[model samples]
Target: MADDRFSMGLFDARIKDQRHQVFKVLGMYFVLMTVAIWGLLSLFWGSTYQLESYFPSVKVYVYDFDSVATPNAVLGPAVVRYLQSTLSSPVHLGIIVRDPAGKTFDDVASEIVGEKAWGAVVINANATSNFEAAMAGTGGLLDGQWAPKGAISLVVAGARWYQVVLEYLLPYLGMYVETPVLEASHQASASFLSTATPATLGELTSAQQAALGTPFAYQEVDLRPILPGQWAGAAPLEAGLIYYIIFAFHIALFFFFSRLPLQGMTKKHGIKIRWIHVCLLRIVPVLFAYFILSLAYTLINKAFLLPTDGNGYASFGPQAGFMVLWMLDWIALASLGLAMEAMLTLLTLKFFPLFLITWILSNITSSFFPATLAPKIFRYGYMMPFWHCTTATKHIMWGTRNRLGLNFGVLLGWCGVSLVTICLFELMWRRIEERKERQESAKDVEGQGAHK
Candidate 1:
């Protein structure tokens, strides 16, 4: 009895052996987790590191409608020449010189609204004519109003990408587009004033003289303006994405624990259930859970009074828009939750947190930044669920391009992939468990025979 007690004591050889085994296990865990964390950080941080290098990928059309025959196509041609020169500069863009032959300003605006181009600098058809007339003191000018601003239309769809537009595109336009155009107008006006007869000089009114000072101002037409109230919509696109995955993961965890009692009843209380029924039991409840969770999630946006009327983009009324948003949230939740559920079977609880970090990082990195401004690798974000969901959310909230069909299709495709993988993984895990149980029972039988 003394020897047996000694074997179980703190100094026992068995205890010493187990300590080495524990250390070895911890060492391996630490090394692998460190590698995983570093790898994930690299992926997350790499996306935006050289974003400025890819600035030229953002296409901005420069349509020179004013370059046609007029007394002097000075302002329009000067603006286009200055903008084209910037293509070779350090901070350049995809400044495509669009043929303004048959394309009207409306056509250019449509291209922007349809997302064919990030933005446009339309030297309006009347740009030179209007400015020349204003300079000649013969054009229509309202009281204290500037006409050159209306001469050039700078078309941008803010809802296309609020952050990208605000941060990069708008500033780029201000620098490369607005600045050059203003300079050209001022120079043109100065040259005209230098050669003007006393009659032309005296004809200039105070408002017209002010307009001549800045002869070519751009009228910034944001087809889909991101209103102040709509700033709350960023939640779903940015930080809220992490919360979405966390919520889905918790739902998976809750149901996993909930199923344990049923599993115990089958094992300990001699209760029986088919494996297919078990799979259904796990999947169906989570789907319903996402449905409820998504509605509650959407209601938070609604409660905060985020616009649901598509901000003048879509035809959906307030109530219909709310329902659309709810449905979008439901599908987005299902896409995120189902994928987590599928991965949980293969990764299990021990290793799932690593996968969780990878999932969140991958989705967040791809969705948060515009792919055109990032490396080509991030263009894969176009297919990611978070990207599509973010795009659809913008469409629903701020009225960006209405690609609802494609967004929904991609999200549902992710759901389909998750569903198939869940079934396969569930079946695989079940087979593994059954095989372990069979091996355990065989060992027991062999031990009993040896005892006899």
Candidate 2:
């Protein structure tokens, strides 16, 4: 009995030593592999979507309803030219002038929505006459006062890209219009100071007041609105919800995957279960957590950002679609993660590979900016699950256009690939483990012989 107890103790010690050796080798290999991959990715795909790295360029369609003799023709061409010159390289203009006056705002809007141009500048037929009237202090709320009326209409796409374009263009255009008006006002003021009369003094002051700002009062029209009216004010909440939903899945993934090894080890000894069944069992909790979190997130967003007095879930088509897409996305990502973890464990039992993989995927996902804006070298990011996931999420929440079918295809493709890879690697691992066990048996016999 004492001999059997001693042998059991020795066997346990050997197993512990083998585990220590496995971990030591895996730790070193994981570190080296992670560093090598990270270095290569950074070298090839340098930071691509930085605002400071490049200036923003916009496509503009200009429609002039005024004839060559009118101020619209002169001012419209001049404004377009100024815009072309003012925006520096990497931020240059692509301006097209449409001649036909029949093109309506809807035509321009459709084009903008279709990604033809960032904005359209529409010069009304009455623009020149209106400008003249405003300058003459006639046909406006200004009975005797001089308040300029806007003649041109600025129709801009309401996407994030167009917002950036407008931020660069609008100020410069305003300054261009105001500069001439101010110069004329200054000249008039100087002229009137020398020849002082009651009428002249009033004229001088009126001219100065009118020229203090832009003479043109352009009306801004939104081509695409995320929410009805201006939702730019709620940008923070919108963005927060996106990040929250994404990271919530990520967090759940991290928590559940960490216990996967323990789950495998603690399987009932007498019961025989298929590997796929085991995988499905593990996935159930992740799905439950994901659904609950998704529901909570939707409730919060509706309560604050998209609040309606009635039942929010009644008109929850988009939200339901978003949830289904999110579920597929997380599942694909989780499957991919599992496959990677299994492959890495076969090579090295350390958890460092999981971290490395997660970190790399997070970087390339391009959640902060549109993947289109990313560098050409980083175009592989388009195939990543999270990129499509975030994109589909944006489309659902903010009403942005996206290829939902394509996104779904990409995610499912990843899942199929991962499951296949995991199966192959797991089979390979079983063979490798068998070989190692046989080798260990041989060593044990040799050690016994040496002891004898």
Candidate 3:
């Protein structure tokens, strides 16, 4: 029987062949992982100083007509202050009024927008009270959202920081709109809308309490103790989805290329590992291995030279589980990669095709840089697994626990599909193996007959 003890012993012994290659593979893997981890650590380590260098510094030039020069001075500072109040102040960005060669506001916008400028805000004459009106009213003239009654050009860069400025732009355009995240919750306006509104100063007062209904509402989106930390502070659901896809591919590649070639970890004497069994076997091994990797990653990120702050105990188990579940997807990738390797192994190809595919996809996916930063056309491409894993790892390190559940779900899907694929491949191989055995036996019988 295939289950005979002596046969099993020989089968087990076959694994030793793989042992010869382990140290070499491990050395290569260690070098690569170490370089990557160190480079990442260096960036975050330097972020403290690098963050200060910019200090909200994006020099946005605002060229306006002389008529609005007085309003510009007042409006500029007010815009800067509003920005300061709303944003997390990592950058020092503001509008600077300059009339180079006495060019008109339109002239400046035309020149700058074409030269790859970030954004532009042109204030109309008598637009000073617009900010004041906005602080007091909802929106209409200088006191409303969009165009600010007389604003000329307020085009967004349509790139990385669009969301950051989309809602806030109206507040600065004519100082008329107030779109605060917390305006709906807790309902605390600046506690005072306009400190300089004529109506408030000239008419409304505490002494005339009966006439005044209530002051304007002010609110700010303050997520203090930002739960997931800086690395995982983004929209969790979307981010988690992305990371799940990326890591699925990475682990799958590692499994197919690295783990399988190690020999005994994969090969099993004459047993035809159907695609299903192949997939199942891989899933079991990798789930154990990968989760451990996740744990190792977490420990290093937390307790090492540079620790990523997060809820360690709560985070470690869930993130590791999520990371392991990704093997389903890894199985799919591993299937494709292994197929290529299998072809090379049998046919002696000059190079492994899967490596190129993995490398290319890895570059585009699981990148540390944001996919949204990619050109609008390419943004969706980044949603694939390669990018997702990078983001997911960051999420895990940042203690974003809720997303761990979501990642686990997505990864499970990949595992199921991969298991099916492996079973199919194994069945095909079994037939081939059986046929070869028959051919060899027939040749042996023919040789006996010739001797007779």
Could you tell me every candidate's TM-score relative to the true structure?
0.92, 0.63, 0.37
Q: Residue 350 deviation, candidate 3, in Å?
A: 8.2
**Full-model lDDT, candidate 3:** 0.41
Question: What are the per-model C-alpha RMSD values against the true structure?
Answer: 3.2, 7.9, 15.5
> Predicted candidate 1: what Cα RMSD to the true structure?
3.2
Write one digit per residue (lDDT tens) for candidate 1, span 152-271.
777899878877887888788877766677677777777787898998778778877877677777778888897877677788778987899999989989888988887897889755
Model 2 lowest lDDT segment of ten: 307-316
The most accurate candidate by lDDT is 1
Model 2 residue 125 lDDT? 57
Candidate 2 lDDT, 1-452, residue by residue in tens: 46765566534766898878878998987887788679655633454436433334345677766443364343455445545554554544455667645676677777765667666776555544544444445543255554444456667655434335456545444454454334433443454355656674467445444633334445666554445543532442335434543554455457557767765765544233466664555445555655565565555545555422112222346557545544644554554354444455344444444554454545344544444444555556677655665555544554445556777788677657655665566567556866987999999999999999
Q: Best-fitting candidate, measured by TM-score?
A: 1
Off by over 4 Å in 1: 1-14, 69-71, 198-203, 270-272, 444-452
- Badly placed stretches (over 4 Å) of model 3 are 1-281, 304-353, 356-360, 363-383, 391-407, 447-452
| TM-score-based ranking | 1, 2, 3
lDDT of 1: 0.83
Where's the lowest-lDDT run of ten residues in candidate 1?
1-10
Candidate 1 matches the true fold with a TM-score of 0.92
